[model samples]
Target: MNAEARNARWNVLGLLPAQLIMLATLIVPVGIIVLVSFSTRGPYGGFDYVFTTAPYRQILFNEGWTGELEFNPQYLIVVARTMILAAATTFICLLLSFPVAYFISLQKATAKMLLIYLVTLPFWVSMIVRVYSWIIILGNDGVIAKTLHALGLVDNMGSLLFTDTAMLIGLVYSYIPLMILPIFASIEKLDPALVEASHDLYGSRLTTLRRVILPLCRPGMMAGSILVFVPCLGAVLEPILLGGGKTMMMGNLIQLQFGAARNWPLGAAISIVLMAAVLVFLVWRGLRAIRRERAEAAA
Candidate 1:
């Protein structure tokens, strides 16, 4: 065989061990979850081999267990609200991150590094700590309220804790880094010459940004959206801690079933449904990306 063919064979062979380890660790556990989601729960809250659609039906109709997960009107409203929150959070993160990334891309190397470091500084602390800290910062007697009161900006204390706004703040704070990184990566690779060329061709800044910059950054935006949205869909910590446990997300619901309710199969089913939703979104993005790449190639 030629050298290139031999090298390709060796590369494939080299990847086999790591791939096998991943399959054993992740793929196997996911397969088990899928199976359990479709099966019945035992009396004591374990998987029973008896196959049933009751779990899925419960989720749809909000019936099984306490009948909440079923598709009743109240449950439907909650589910819809959850989806809306996820969508809103994703859209907002993208809108904010894009401009920050654009600004950073234009900065000198030292300033850019400092800005990027600031964006990621939160990661130096634990996520739980960050979420919990918001309570102190936004509570009735929290930092903002106290500071305002001290400065005579307000006559009375204002309660900001345990609200949807607080929840959103936590979500945005936690995931901003996740949104920024991919966009920065996409922007960093952009050719400065192209922007200059667009300007020379008499394109206004707005026109150049909309037409030239955004199109090239589409892939990055898509990737960053996925990074932010998928985790936000299942966000458990920020909501529970900052939203004062009033917020009920799929992640929280799934955890409740397995922990307090002692219903493994139902919990597994909810988890599977959540995973499926995320998978569908990812698949849609992947297909769109593939189509874009193909169209670009053809053109």
Candidate 2:
């Protein structure tokens, strides 16, 4: 073969490992889930090999005692709660992270490195441990309650645990570092000249931030949001631990199906649905990003 063709062949060979890994990891598992989602539940636990659409059908409808399918909004409620919590967590992280990241980015090189290390120090501990710590802090008779009692703020020590507020606190604490790191990276790479130009043009502080800094940091903000939001959707620990099993999220529902519910088909179906929704969001974001890039190029 000629040199060009030989080099092209080697390049294709170089990509084989990555292709095989994706096939083994992503594609194969998804293919199995899709297959299972279309199958029927077994007589006992597990799934039957029989082909049926009952799993997906049951997502929105339930077979009644009289053998009639009735519309059910239970799972939809869980989905809505999951989305709201994830969105709220992402927004809160973004709000809290921007100032911290900007401050870190503005520090001297040594101080910046030290601050980054401090921000990431929490990651060294296990997530379960960190979550458990929040439980202690939010639980009745925990630190907050004790402090309140000492200050005579209230007659009784109040607890915030096992509530949506507690979940938000845990989620924000756990994911804020993720948001901060990405935004810090983006801000670090920003050109100071852009801010200087904005100020020179008689821009107010807010105007400079809105017109210059924010636009530059958009990519980082997007990345951080995706990182925080996606995991928050499937967060089993925070909801279970902080919400105290009173609040049900999509992850909890999926776990129930696979474990106690013993409805693999339904679980797989839910998994597929969640996966599809996330895939749609990611694709839309990617397309929008591509369009923006193209528009910028044209301009």
Candidate 3:
């Protein structure tokens, strides 16, 4: 065979193992969940062999004993809340990450490496431990409260934990690195001469950022937004720990269904729905990437 053909064959061979692993780990489990979503709930827990649409119906509507369907908003509200929180987290992460990423990108190689390491230092700790640390820091008697009380900012150690604000703070803190890394990747590749040219033309820093840097970093921003938003949509630990079990997100609801509620079918259905939403987002991103590539090629 020719050199190109032999290389192509080798590439396919190299990918075969990964393909099999993905099929086994991801595709198979998702297929099982999709199948279970259509099945009937058993007497105690788990699911029965009988196929039914009751789970989906229950998510969207309430059925009376007489079989009259009424619109239900409970699950929809949970989904909406999840989406809102995820979006908010993504926005906050974007705002916080941009400056940090730009600063890192502008640093010398050694300094950049150290800054990157610091940015990712939290990952060295266990996620659960990091989250628990937030609990201590944000607790009423924790550092913030103590500092505030010492300064006489408040009459008491006011509650900061177990609130939506606390949950948002945790989400932003946890996901900010995900946002920063991508933007830094993009900014590091940017041509410094372009910034010099803009400045030579007497462009202000804010103007250059708006017209030059942001446009160039759009891909990284989009990637970071998706990375932050998708997982935030399915966040469980932050809501449970920080919100004090009062905030119910989609992930928390799914956990409850599978654990406490003992409704495997419903849980599977919710999982399927969440997966579908993520798939939709992925497809949208893929299409946008393709179009952008085409536009760049055309230009």
Candidate 4:
């Protein structure tokens, strides 16, 4: 056989193991979930192997006392809250990350390395540990409350731990690194000459930033936003510990179905629905990216 053909065969052989692993680990589990989502729940809270769409229907309507399907907005509210919080987390992360990334990108080599290391230092500890630290900081006798009392800002120590603000803080802290790294990589690729030219053209710093830097950084920002947003949609730990279980999100709802609710089909259905929503979003973004590339090519 020719050398090129021989090399191609070897490359395909090398990829076989990874392909099989993905099939076994990823695809098989997802296939099982999909099948389970369509099956009815057993009398005792497991798969019944009976075909039905009741689980999917249960998302929007619950069975009423008269055995009729009635419109229910409880699950819908959880879905909305999940979307809102995820969007807010993405926006906050973007805002916080861009400045840190830009600062890191502009630093001297050794300083830049140190700053990047600091940015990622939180990852060295377990996430649960990090989250627990926040619980201490936001608790009634925690740092913020104690400091406020010392400053005479409040008459007494009041807790910040069980609020939406605390949850947002935790989410942002958890995912901000994901946002920063991508934007920093993009900023590193930027040419200093471009900014210098903008300045030479009598452009104010703000004007130059808005016109030149932001456009160039768009790709990284989008990627970072996606990284933060998608995971936030399914975040469980922050909402539970930080929000004190007062707030319910899609992830928490899914956990309820599988755990206390004992409805495997419903949980599987919610999982499928969430996956479908993410898939749709990805497809939309892919199409928009393709269109932008074509337009740029034409330009």
TM per candidate:
0.91, 0.95, 0.95, 0.95
Worst 10 residues of 1 by lDDT: 67-76
TM-score, cand. 4: 0.95
Candidate 2 local lDDT, residue 2 = 100
Question: All models: lDDT?
Answer: 0.84, 0.93, 0.92, 0.93
Q: Candidate 1 — which residues are off by over 4 angstroms? A: 62-76
lDDT of 2 by residue, 1-299 (tens): 89999999999999999999999999999999999999888766688889999898899999777998899888999999999999999999999999999999989999999999999999999999999999888888788988888999966855799888999999999999999999999999899999999999999999999999999999999999999999999999998899888878999999999888989999999999999999999999999999999999999
Worst 10 residues of 3 by lDDT: 57-66
Residues 219-295, candidate 4: write the lDDT tens digits.
99999999999999999999999999897999999999888899999999999999999989989998999999999
Residues 1-299, candidate 1, lDDT per residue (tens digit)? Answer: 99999999999999999999999998999999989988888777777888898877776575456645435554345556667877788788999999999899889999999999999999999999988889899988899999999999997865988889888888888898888989999999999899999999999999999999998898788888888888887889977888888757777887887878778877888788778878897888789879988998999
Q: Candidate 4 at 116: error in angstroms?
A: 1.1
Candidate 4 — which pairs collide? Answer: none
Poorest 10 consecutive residues by lDDT, candidate 2:
154-163
When summed lDDT is taken over every stretch of 10 residues in candidate 4, the lowest stretch is 153-162
